[model samples]
Target: MQFGDFYYPLPANEPVLQYAPGSKEKAALKAALKQLKSEKIEVPMYIGADEVHTANKSTMHPPHQHKHVLGTYSEGDAGHVKKAINAALKAKDKWANLSWENRANIFLKAADLLATKYRFQMVAATMHGQSKNAYQAEIDSACELIDFLRFNVHFLSEIYRQQPISVAGIQNRVEYRPLEGFVLAVSPFNFTAIGGNLPTSAAMCGNVVVWKPAHTQVYSAQLFMRILKEAGLPNGVINLIYVDGPVLGEECFNHPDFAGVHFTGSTGVFNHMWKTIGENMSKYKSYPRIVGETGGKDFVLIHKSANPDVVVAALLRGAFEYQGQKCSAASRAYLPSNIATEIKKKMVAELKEMKMGSVEDFTNFVNAVIDEKSFDKIERYIKNARKRDSGAKVIAGGKCDKTEGYFIEPTVIETTDPYYVTMCEEIFGPVLTIYVYDENKFDDILKIVDNTSPYALTGAIIAQDRYAVELATNKLRNSAGNFYINDKPTGAVVGQQPFGGARASGTNDKAGSILNLYRWLSARTVKEVLTPVTDYRYPFLQEK
Candidate 1:
């Protein structure tokens, strides 16, 4: 078939649904939740077109109600990881050689499906599986996932449209080719959109992928795989498997076909994988691309001139939303001493008024952390702060309970030291630590904030003075990948703020933008000669 010039529909951010009480969306979401709770699902590994099952199985449970079983997933071992890698390699050549327009169309179709028909299902899966409330689910599974697919298509086209300048007698052209081998996409449980994006981003660039999503996220992940399949993604082009991470990592990292990894997880895991890939570098046909986003001890700094209400609101939303499971969640705060007492009073009052429970309860603003391990970690941090007599004190909501689910109160810890453990560490839960600073020492505190953490993912500065804002903007420029002027650090829109951080945070490749798609491709330049010279002798040799 002849290739046709193709232009995708202009992309737009998917609108987030409020799912207000008594609204149609609210009713539909309730029905979906009920259906999900009523039934138990069986998720299998997809290698090529085959649905493979193993003897091993793991039960899926919601973090809000741990006793309630949502489903079971087949857990594959090292053998299955090898099988997935082989399946991806088997499908690599045909998928890579397929017409670019055809490849783009599949993902575009998937985005359309997600935007309309499968919208509620995606949101529902996120809510039921990932413990996100309706609004959170809408923003993540529905909105962000749709944006990733559509924007990546636009970006891929842009990559292809890039051409080289040619000399008078020669015409030069550039082609964006997929990686020579398969990609291994390792996604986290926090964002369903991320789980979908990491795998499809590579696939959209004409590369095959062996995707292994976190076990906690596989429930929504199953729906994502089905959507891709229905959108006409050919079997084996993207193989979805559920396996132990270490086992899978060992198999994929040692395989010659492993071309790259698109990872979003903890720093420790990414570091180990990076070291393993480096040690096994000679075993691969090509150097593998490592694009990762890891841990972040994000921050929020408020100047004395800032509005207390605005600071409180930003803290409440940025630190407590989704129970602070976001890598960009504001974990540390630096408030001017003059306004610190007022901000703390209002923050504590609001924290007391806020409701925390299951996501099914729309009235509740906060939900449980992802699992028991996370809850325990957050609790340990709070407990440790309470025990310390000198550095820090728990000022509000320091309680935790795991009887019903993995629930940790929306905690606020006030610290005397700017570099307190809570301020420096990535708690990854609903915990915010405040360190009040003198109004005159804003510049000194900015330096401390910048140097305090190994992470530099997301951070915000709230100040009314234009000079203060400008100074912080310039001083902390390298402190965060997504920096905000007067807003919270969380809730980064896909296309507008191409997210990802530098230093310990990640490679800063900026997912949800053209740069991320560029990582998955290799460029080839072709120069065509219009005319050939018959004489081979040079004038310089004869005339000199």
Candidate 2:
């Protein structure tokens, strides 16, 4: 079986298509969107070799156009969760024992199919189902997902090659064994790439997975599931389910075969899962690995010496791209007083030019939030800021309208109080809260930035002053896991900047890197004596 050395060399990140006007991708994407919209799809839960459907079903619609139905997926109870777990466990031995090269090639082939054949269809699904604009859809569903599939293969290969050194007349190697049981992949609605990565990352390591996507993201999630099947993924290797969170958790957490969880969502949920696992530690076959990336109150700190124009662009894109739904989105800001006025003026002017509407239109920069619940939560934040006694003033785009879709204008709030609720909380929307600091008190403001939020996820500092950048980087080292200099705080590419954070932002396992892959693996040190043992006693026992 170990006849030859097989290698999966590091792969380049997939190129993001621009989808320019009149381009082939644009045309293909438009067609895909039209075709998808014209038809209604019935999505079934994939459990083992069965497509399980139930009388209880949930319909999906585009977040930007709630009136139009996209599809309906089967909703299951606790029973389905048990079925999924059982299916995963049933498939575990064969999947885990399969040759590593064959396992790697299956995902590699999926990446190619996504990059070429299913590219437009995948992008269109994200655009319609998640309300992401064309560019965002292309980047997330098409490009990033492809990169995750490809890059993870290379990352895992690197892990496999790391064998321990052996001494004379002895051979030693480390076997990266998959966890003893099944993994649970709970993914959020924000990023399609995250949805794909969560399940496949565990499965790529020869572990079977029970994947549960956010109800709102199942449209694209199901499509990716089908693609995986077409790419030769066997049934029960990754069981896709749609079930309520509590029902799923009660079953999986209580199951003895629970091996680990690959999660991306809120800090509250991650903490609860960790607590539940701790409470049920004795019931599990092995200690369950928990890897999660959670919430953030990501920030942008500007210096007086920074260019106002650069700050305006960074603030606009960082705070509003994908409607500020990213965990790494710039939600709070500390601006120097010297440039605040000019920056605010330019930011408002730019916000005015931005088009807010459905994702079907190629020109719209801001789209709707996820759903009605998210829309209301965001509206409350804006309304709270507008209160006369709140010490925060809406500087630009505070309008909220859900007449057509869950639309909230790209809003900017300037607060006199540094401790304003809007400045401290994780409002995952397009409402950015800014606090102006005196130019002379840059060092003091850095301290405030560090102490303001419980999250240490992502933050940016834009300044021409090198010393200012260095000072902020050093002083606010623990404030953010991903720090940007002279740039915005969002847009982390796979394999380049490994993403995740500490301190209330989950485990900081750094997805998109080998660090995350290690979570699903249990290493076994294999040692073989080349020289035959002639005696029962060792040299030390015989001599001394």
Candidate 3:
């Protein structure tokens, strides 16, 4: 394995499996789901080499089947957060000093295992725990995580190959060392890939990490942790813990060795953490690197030349897939008056036809949202939109039923007001709001689209006319980080579109790129002079 200098070419994105009927993948995943559902296991926090389970346990339930207990995870307090930090620090030196190729191989091996050995199980866990249907689980938990692992290894390799050019009889080198202290990775429940990538990306860069995944994601998060262990990750390199967010933050932010944090969640939480870290800056050994991707009130803009069918499909998939839990989901739309009627008619009809239920039944196009809190939040938004004075009329789907599980009907509201609260604020749910604009005033509408929302995470402009497309593109250039043309704003592939946004959305470090990897690294340049300077004097100092 150490025969020569390592060269890992760009890795391809993992192909998303379509678990169609009678497909082998479908059968395997069904089996995995059955197996997981049949057993109730006790999950523990992984601290150093130990599986730390406490009496304080929180039960895990399928979002689509709240009564069915998947398992229980040991909930920790500030003490466990402290332990995780200590574990990361204890393993820091060895993990950082490990051979670069070996470090790279561990992640490579993990990627392979995820793609092959545990593929079905991983997808199954996501489907059950996150309430994601088959295709949604495949694209997110399987394909995206696999792509992140493989592509990260390749990206880190490229980073290691960068060196300074040497002059005559002098050799120059730069060492991309891991940061002096530990990294804290706080990942959200929406994407299991982020839960895995947040910790592994830092650990892959020779920095040890303490990962605290959202409590709702523990079902799949624990599975990925096991895969990492099996893939030869050294103990304490990445410590996984389940704890109260504030307690964990209090401990980590106050610690002197808190090197950095890789985060993905809401803008409010991200802003709070930034403030906390800033307040405790003097306590840290070095300036802590804060990288985060926060909330998005993403948009979809329609033009007169846009195909009604295309707009309908884009809105259907973009707004309701995974119950519109995605941060990049198209929550708002600006439809041209010329084609808006046709698009709305088609969209409403399609929504009526789509089935909604548990992920167990693959035919269900819409599943339950994450949990009760999210269910209530989405319900509030729908209720507010229904008020007569709100000036927004529900065109289709505004039902919230939680008898069996937290389910919200895929709702669409058409409002005459452009900056209606539902359209401006972040609503992480199965709701889409549309505002009709004069077809000829496309440019003016684009300005409203740009200025309406504070978030600039993701957006799309659907148009067949080149001039209209170009105008919207130029006008809304800063409106979205990942701008799509004639396509839904969500579903950004890893290697193809590195995702993140600025202006309160996040630091825009652009995860899945070398830019994110560089945050975990601290560089040191060394220049060896073959001809040593005899004195600290130059020709000018010597009066030459």
Model 3 error, position 488 (Å): 0.2
Q: Which ten contiguous residues of candidate 3 have the minimum total lDDT?
A: 535-544
Candidate 1 vs candidate 2: the lDDT winner is 2
Please give the clash total of every predicted structure, in order: 0, 0, 0
Candidate 3, residues 1-544, lDDT tens digits: the string is 3467686899988988998789999999999999999999899999999999999999999998899999999999999999999999999999998988899999999999999999999999999999999999999999999999989888988999999999898999999999989999999999999999999999999999999999999999999999999999999999999998999999999999999999999999999999999999999999999999999999999999999999999999999999999999999998989888889889999998999999999999999999999999999989998999989988899999999999999999999999899999998999999999999987788889989989999999999999988988899888898899999999988889999988778988888888889999999999999999888876786653
TM-score for candidate 1, residues paired by index: 0.98
Q: Which stretches of candidate 1 lie over 4 Å from their true place?
A: 388-390, 542-544
What is the Cα-based lDDT of residue 325 in candidate 1? 96
Q: Please list the Cα RMSD from the true structure of every candidate, rounded to 1 decimal place.
A: 1.1, 1.4, 1.3
Q: Work out the TM-score per prediction.
A: 0.98, 0.98, 0.98
- How do the residues 1-544 of candidate 2 rate in per-residue lDDT, one tens digit apiece? 6677678998998998998988998999999999999989999999999999999989999999999999899998999999998999899899999998899999999999999999999999999999999999988999889989998999999999998999899999999999999999999999999999999999999999999999999999999999999999998999999998999999999999999999999999999999999999999999999999999999999999999988988989999999999999999998899988888888888999999998888899999999999999999999988999889899899899998899999999999988899888999999999999999999899989999999999999999999999999999899998999988999999999899999988888988898999998999998999997887976778654
Go through the candidates in order and give each one's C-alpha lDDT: 0.91, 0.93, 0.93
Best-to-worst ranking by lDDT: 2, 3, 1
lDDT of 2: 0.93
